[model samples]
Target: MSLDAAPGIIAVTLVTVATVAIGTWGLRFSRTTSDFFVASRTVHPRLNASAIGGEYLSAASFLGIAGLVLTFGAEMLWYPIGWTAGYLVLLVLVAAPLRRSGAYTLPDFAEARLGSRAIRLLCSLLVVAIGWLYLMPQFQGAGITLHAVAGAPTWTGPLIVGAVVLVNVMSGGMRSITFVQAFQYWLKLTALLLPAAVLLIVWAGEGRPRPDVDAAWSLPLADGGGIGLYTTYSLILATFLGTMGLPHVVVRFYTNPDGRAARQTTLTVLALLGVFYLIPPVYGALGRVHTAELASADALVLELPRLMLPGPLGDVLTGLVVAGAFAAFLSTSSGLTIALAGVLSQDLVAKLPQHRLSGVAAFRLASVVAVAIPCIAAVAVPHVSIARAVGLAFAVAASTFCPLLLLGIWWRRLTDVGAAAGLMIGFVGSGGAVVWTLSGGSEPPLLDALLAQPAAWSVPLAFAAMVLGSLCTPRRVPAHTSRLLVRLHTPESVPLDRG
Candidate 1:
């Protein structure tokens, strides 16, 4: 079944134009750096929740997760479950306090909590790396969707998405992005849900044949698996804890009016994501019954829409699916780009003595830098699995920022020496594993285990290393730890007075 490029392209083009128009209209209200960065810290809970849901459900959620379920069965459902539940953990453990701390980025939190410029710089580098890695799949997924729906060349999708993201992010920054993402979330949910209902009903009418539970559905990790259980656990650890450390995700918490609103926003996101996720696995399950010889398991979601609903109905549904896939691409890329641009503007461009680039100049330059590297990487390394690529990003996040944020916020005993040690250990351990995996070296049994699931061990090693290192070098602990804690937890209603 081939897609009719004209109607599908027209539909996708309309959706893209509408989204950009909405975002552009938002720019009139974004007059300050604060507005651009964090929506002036006044975003209501419901809108903020939708924006969070939009940003969180990227290409991985839209395409990769459903594809994974189709390819790997019950085990793959854990990815979405782990991902959605991570926000619950964030709400219970970190959200309120993180917002109350009033830090703009993870590095901002690091410097405030640990009082180490060196640690902050290291954290910044990791943020760029993780953000770039995460961005690649979004671009790639966009390319795939365009190719599937419009019969356009593969590059068309990424190019279109990359351009749209650059315009939205550069023009209005976070404020514009929040509105765009919130709107896109609804579009995405509707795109997936509507087709799913139609397809399911059609499927029921055609006689509800059970999926091959024994053939594909019943396979285990031991049977020609991509990675083993150890690796699976590591991935779970990364996705589960990585949300807390992601610069984009963490930055969203700061957009809330207060700590309580931040917590509420997270809860709303969980419900939104829960509703969106339920439909994907249904597509995956149905794909097993309707389609044969799926070229790429990652293409399962897109292909299912085309297979189940052929002709113009299928084309329209496919077009909506394409638009949602692009939404996944645009929303995720925009959020990451904004986070990256903020870091670059503050760290790289603003530091020059004679020339200070702030506001739109800094943002535009940062957007170019933010989008270019990942775009290049996406073009260069096109073969990596989207889900696994996302997992690597999570591993990096879990390894580096996860330790720093948890320790910075919770442990007053954390010292610069300890923080530095943990960062180095995490970088070397997780970074080396990633390098080994990518370099095509003969991975040892133990090394394979380590590389595949570094988070389980690496995270603990980082924490242990930090603690032991701090204990041995207590002098490096900031003397103002208690004062910092007080400031971090204190409500905004109370004013700080320095006499």
Candidate 2:
């Protein structure tokens, strides 16, 4: 069934215009740099939760997961479950402390906790790397969605979303984006859910045909299964820990009023994500019954509407799905760009004495730099799977910032030398894997295993390196560990000066 481009294009264009308008209106309330950066640290938990859900549920959650379910069967459900469950880990372990640290970026947190500019610099590089890796998939998904629905050139989608995201992010920073994302989260959920319900009913009315469960559901780690298992485990590790390390996700914590509020935000995010995740698997399972083509799996969510319900209803629904797919791209990319821009502004562009840039000017400049690089990469290398590229981003996040944040916040013995050593090991290990994969080099079995699932080993290796490095140079441990710990865990109600 071919999608007519006219209606879908109109619907997506309208939605994009409305989203930007609303974001621009949101800027009226954003008067200060603090407002732009953290909404003056006053965003309510419910709204923040929705924004988090919006930002977290990127192309992977919206389109890729359903596609995976269509192509790979029940095992693919683990991706969504792991993605949502990672929030539980974040809530239990990191959220509040991270919020209480009062850092704008991950590097800010690192420098605050470790008291090391060098460590902050290292963390900055990782933040940009992870953000770019994650951003590529969002752009790619945009291109795919536009090509599917609008019949436009594939690059059009990424270009459109990239422009919209830059406009929204540069206009108001976190202040405008928080509201925009919260709204988009509901828009995306409705776009997917309404069509899902209609399609399910249509499928039921036409006489329910069971999916080819036997062919797709078989599971055993043999007959070329070892590679799948290895990749799966690596993916699991990446998503499990990557949430904590993502600069965009971490930056959201800073928007909370306090550590406790950050924890509460995470809990709400978990519930929102859990509810949203249930819808995608339905699309996947239904796609299995309706459209079995492997290449069509990526278009499963967008195509299901037309397949089940033909004529005007299907076109409208398809248009809505197209708009939501664009939302997935725009919201996620906006958050990622914001995070990347913040780091680049602080670490790279801010170094010039004459520049003295601060607030919106700094953010806008960084946004341009942040968006341009990934935009080019998305266009230049459009063949990578959205989910796989996103997973690589997560792997990089897991290998680098995960160790730094975990140890920086909790381990008093963490030293600058140790942190630097860990960052170097993780960067080399995960970066090498990514480069090798991109290079298309013939890798040995063990090397391939290491490259694909480096987190399982690389993370441990980083931790060990950091610990050993620290022990060898105990003098490098910050002298203010106790004071910093006290500040991090203390309730926000307590005034620091009074204490």
Candidate 3:
């Protein structure tokens, strides 16, 4: 509430203008269909890593993590740890294989792996479902950030963000967004890093008071005995396994020039995220020392600067943080939108027999549908916590695609029927959990915890279904599985002649 409209409005305008300008520069490189979808597969490792960091560090990192740290204590540190470590999982198991698959979208990879249109359709639905799931909190977070920024109607943030995303994404797709996202990442880092350094100095000056709370808060694990441990492990499972399954995250691999670049990109992302995450804990700690309990904890990042400094200096820092917060929403939403649009355009729009739409035209149309649906949902259901929603999205991805990708890339016996069975089971289990949480369902504490963090059970069940389903349908494995595996594993430089 102490946040002022002056800094908020200025921050919004500045970030928006800079994003559009960078996107415009990227448009020239987006003329081809390949450019629109995957940046012509020419992005460099460091540059692509920055873009990945930009888009990957969503409102969850910018706002939600600080709030959680401020309110819940050290147990919430798992969010950042699992999220970053998920990349290491990606690096070892998935980064190279996914790039070598030569697929533009997750469904394309599924279809290529299984040799079944049915499997493709299932992956497509899951992509849209997961994309929309991830996007809802971003849109909602935009509303929250903007509301704190300038007392704007809660709806304005979503609408404004939706329009900006549509224009940037619909204009030049991935090619256009590469520059925008990379710029936003550094901007976001500066915004947080500088403010955090100043705030820490101020806290030191004030004797660095400890947070006044229960002993349970500083414990690394949940306090609910067995049930608490379950929730903690489930959250860990979702975030750790979920990175490889996210469509936006996966599609970035496709943009790499080859498997090697993809691996390099993941490594760089780890370092960048490590540096960026350090600052949020600073704000959370400073909040403990300087500010009282906040009505909107998610706004802690924005409020801390203004409250702690309490002058022109604080207002200036507040403006910088605001810009970074807005950048978080825009960058993440754009990446999700691009990934969703690519899936929709490829699996739905391009296949429409009634319309003779060009690939670019179809992609443009898909982009509209992608951003519009979640924008509406964000506005309609505006009360969910940004961090929790993203975590759920991670859970769904872990349950569904994590099994498929891990199995498909490594296990050759994975039949189309098996993949389809596993995807459906994962979909239903994780989707059910999502529905229960979103619907505000509650029960005895244990049941609520189980459903709330369903990844522990849902993920294992999905893997079991795939393994058993494949073992049972041994003869149903695709005939080309051997050749495809060779291609997936072979170095691009040592190509086998197709002839």
Best by TM-score: 3
lDDT of each: 0.81, 0.83, 0.91
Order the numbered candidates by lDDT, best leading: 3, 2, 1
Give per-model TM-scores: 0.94, 0.95, 0.98
Question: Ten consecutive residues with minimal summed lDDT in candidate 2?
Answer: 215-224
What RMSD does model 3 have?
1.4
Total clashes, candidate 3?
Answer: 0
**What lDDT does candidate 3 reach at residue 95?**
93
**Candidate 3: worst 10 consecutive residues by lDDT?**
490-499
Candidate 3, residues 1-499, lDDT tens digits: the string is: 4446788789899999999989988998789899999999999999999999999999999999999888888888999999999999999999998999999999999988889998999999999999999999999888998888788888999999999999999888998899999999999999999989898888778787776767887787876899999999999999999999998999999999998999999999999999998889877877877757665889999888888898888989989999999999999999999999999999899999999899999999999999999999998874767888999999999999999999999999999888888889998998998899998969889999988999999999999999999999999998888888887887889968411
**For model 3, which pairs clash?**
none
Please estimate how well model 3 matches the true structure, expressed as its whole-model Cα lDDT. Answer: 0.91
lDDT of 1 by residue, 1-499 (tens): 2436765677678878977898999999898999888988999999999999999899898889778777777667767887887788788778988898778888888888888888888888888988998998888887777776666777777788889999888888889889999999999999889889989998898899887666646543423354566766777787788778787899899999988888899999999989998988897788778756766677777778678777878877877787788788899999999999888877777776787776668768888999989887777774566776787777777887777778777888899889889888987887777766655547466667677657888888887888888889988889788887776666667887311
- As for lDDT, the candidate ahead, 1 or 3, is 3
RMSD, every candidate, angstroms: 2.3, 2.2, 1.4
TM-score of 2: 0.95
